[model samples]
Target chain A: MNDDDILEQAARWRSEGKGVALATVVSTWGSSPRPAGSHLAVDQDGAMIGSVSGGCIEGAVVLEAQEAIKSGNPRLLEFGVSDEDAWAVGLACGGRVQVYVEPIE
Target chain B: MKGALLDRLLAERAAKRPAALVTSLNGGGQSLVTAEETHGDLALPLNVVAAARTALRSDRSGIVEADHSRFFIRVYNPPLRIAVVGAVHIAQALAPMAALAGYEVTVIDPRQAFATESRFPGVRLVTEWPDEALGALRPDRRTAVVTLTHDPKLDDPALEVALRSDAFYIGALGSTRTQAKRLHRLQELGFNQEQLGRIHGPIGLKLGGRAPAEIAIAILAEATQVLHQGEAAEAEAAGAL
Candidate 1:
């Protein structure tokens, strides 16, 4: 989905009284799969609408987003390929990404 | 973004208006910026606004820094539109190819027989006069206007509209002598040399192909070159600034 679609979904979720959070790729250091400004919208139930790091790190980001929605606080999450378990988390492309997750409030 | 601001942004996107969504990564503020105005309480620094405007103009989304803060500018631009001012055989071939390349193609011709849905399936067909059709289309910076009609009556009016608008690429399919005559006519109509220079007369790169499909391919290739190079030129200008 495009950014507009994800944002629209977030708006719908908010209007429906469900908690929502948005995760956006703010920066990339190496061969990141997606570019900056890529977005992923998550509801309280962990349903997502878009992607931040393609398949890599989305699961982690979604988990963080759900937590942010519950806590009403934003979090900045970073994932780098140099991490010991990078491949296990799907960052095998040798890139680093910074994602900012914030609640819809 | 929520409520009215998000609704307004979605409406802008639906209207095909070029805009930018500026998000403050540190402060968690968001705003929508268009050519006309900025909406929402996105108290961005001046430098960040400048950078966001640049990104919006180039139809690119990225991050920028200003006043010790980082902001992401997400650009929203309408799809590239191509107005081919002839429903000739070449239009039949070009429309689908251009659509495959992600351009919204419109084939215009006053001749209803040639501009039928049977001839060009899944392409926007405008059967009005060239001038009227082009005027209503309002070709902008992301639009490419190509005149495939050899008839001076049909082609000239379309050329006039394309020349006056912000269309990025203006091409006319014709031979050398035909192009010369067209140029002379346009000059007589008060178009300056620089304005007339925008026309890629005898349009399309010479690909040594005589078939209609080959000609369509050549036009698409030339149009793509102009479109991408125009973006590069804008990027260079922004970097220099």
Candidate 2:
């Protein structure tokens, strides 16, 4: 779904009493998979919708989003191909992106 | 992101009102900026709010750094819209193609036979007179209005409304001679030269294509060009001001 539809879905999940977090690609550089403003919605059960990147970094983002939901604290996550975690969760493409994850309180 | 703020943002978007969500990375403090107001946990500085307005105008989302903090401004502008004022064969090709390109396509034609559901499956069909239809549609900066009817009664009224509005792109299908004649008529109707110039007559990029679908592609290409270039021009104008 597009980010707007995902936002609507996030609202639905929020109304349903599912603790939800919103992760948005706030900025990108080089061959980033998605543009800034791309969104990924994560719920308490780890269910997710939309995407902040290609399938590569979603698992890591979901973990952070779940943490934000639990702690009621937001996180600014930066990932790039040059990072030590590149092999595990960084974008496979040679690009960098900053994601902001916050609970949908 | 309070639930009430989220709802207000959604409501503003639903109403096609331009807005932005600004968040400071350091504190996670956020604010919503609209044309008239700003509200949220943070009271952003004037420069940051100005940056958000610029982002809204250009329809770009990005990072804005000010006052030793990093802020992300996520702009929420209305979806690009195309109001094709004729359900002719070209529009039969243009409507779905524009939709695929992420435009909200509306085919306006009063002729029921030409504007039937079968002709425009999965596209919005407005079987009202061109002028009335466009009047209600209220074309905005993100809207592109194209008159393909090639009839003065229909195209003229639509052109009048379009030329009076801030529609980013206004195209009318015709040859050079026809365009000249159309311009004369609009000029007689009180539109100044600059306003008349906004109409991209002989519509579409001169791709030298003749088929309906090929012509549609040319029109879409020209419209897309105007959409982006117009945004740049507007930004330059705002900067000048």
Candidate 3:
């Protein structure tokens, strides 16, 4: 799906009473997979509509998104080559990215 | 983000008005910024608002450091568009190619037989006369216009309307002699030298190919070049500060 469709889908899910969280790639450094505005929408049930990373860190982002949905608090997540979570989460492409996750009410 | 704020942002985007959603990385703050107004509950400082306007002008989204926190400026600009004032073979090849390159393509021609759906599937087909079609199209700064009919009757009318608009790129297909003749006619129409110079006659880069598809590639390459000509200036302006 394109960028617009992902946001529309998030709104649709929210209207359906499903908990939704939006994760946007706020910044990137080195050879990041996605640009700064790329989005990934995740629901409480672990369902996702788009991707912030090509495939490198969606799993980690989804986990963070679910947590944000539950806590009702936004989060600024940073993943880089030097972080162990980056390696564990498999952002093995030697790039760094900052994602902002916020719950949709 | 509140649903109401998201709706407003989407509405602004639907109306093709540029907007930015500024989110504080430290959380607990967000604001929606537009050309003449600001929305959302966040009480943004003047520097953040100025940064948002600069981001809108540059058409780039990223993090801005201000207010002792980081704000992510996510921009929403209208999609770029192209209006090809002919349904000829070059347009047939160009329409889909332009679409794939992320431009909304419209093929305009009054000839019913030439502008049929089968000839240009999935592309907007305007059967109205060239001038009327373009007048309605209202070529904006994000738009590109190309005249490929090679007939002055059809091409000239579209060229006249397109030249008057803020279209980022305007090109017409012809030889050097044909371009001189076309320029002469436009000059007679009260267009000044600089206005007439906006028409990139001979339409495309000199790829030295006569095939329709090859010519389309040349045209698209040239248009792409014209489209991105502002980036360097923007970067330079940013650097100067």
The Cα RMSD of model 2 versus the native structure comes to 2.8
lDDT of each residue in B129-177, candidate 2, tens digit only? 9999999999998899999998999999999999889899999999999
Q: Model 1, B1-241: lDDT tens per residue?
A: 5457778877997798888888887887888888877888888677777777898777667788788887878787777899999999999999989987768899999999899999998789999999999999999999999999899999999999999999999999999999999999999999999999999979998898979999999999999999989987887788622
| Model 3 pairs whose backbones collide | none
> Chain B, TM-score, each prediction?
0.87, 0.91, 0.91
After TM-score superposition, the amount by which residue B26's alpha carbon in candidate 1 deviates from its true location, in angstroms, is 1.3
User: What TM-score would every model get versus the actual structure?
Assistant: 0.78, 0.88, 0.88
Candidates 1 and 2, the one with greater lDDT: 2
The candidate scoring highest on DockQ is 3
CAPRI-style class, candidate 2: medium
Better of 1 and 3 by DockQ: 3
A1-105 per-residue lDDT for model 1 (tens digits): 456678789889988999988888878888999987788999999998989876989898888998998888888888897776666788988899888888887
Instruction: State the fraction of real interface contacts model 3 keeps.
Output: 0.71
Candidate 3: regions farther than 4 A off: B175-177, B188-193, B205-218, B238-241
CAPRI quality of model 3: medium
**Which tens-of-lDDT digit does each residue in B1-241 have in candidate 3?**
9889989988887788899898877765788999999998788888888888888776778888886987888888887899999899999999988987778899999999899999888889999999999999899988999999999999999999999999989999999999999999999999999999899988899999999999999999999898777644674686411
Q: Stretches of candidate 1 above 4 Å error? A: A1-23, A29-34, A39-74, A77-86, A89-97, A101-105, B96-102, B174-193, B201-221, B239-241
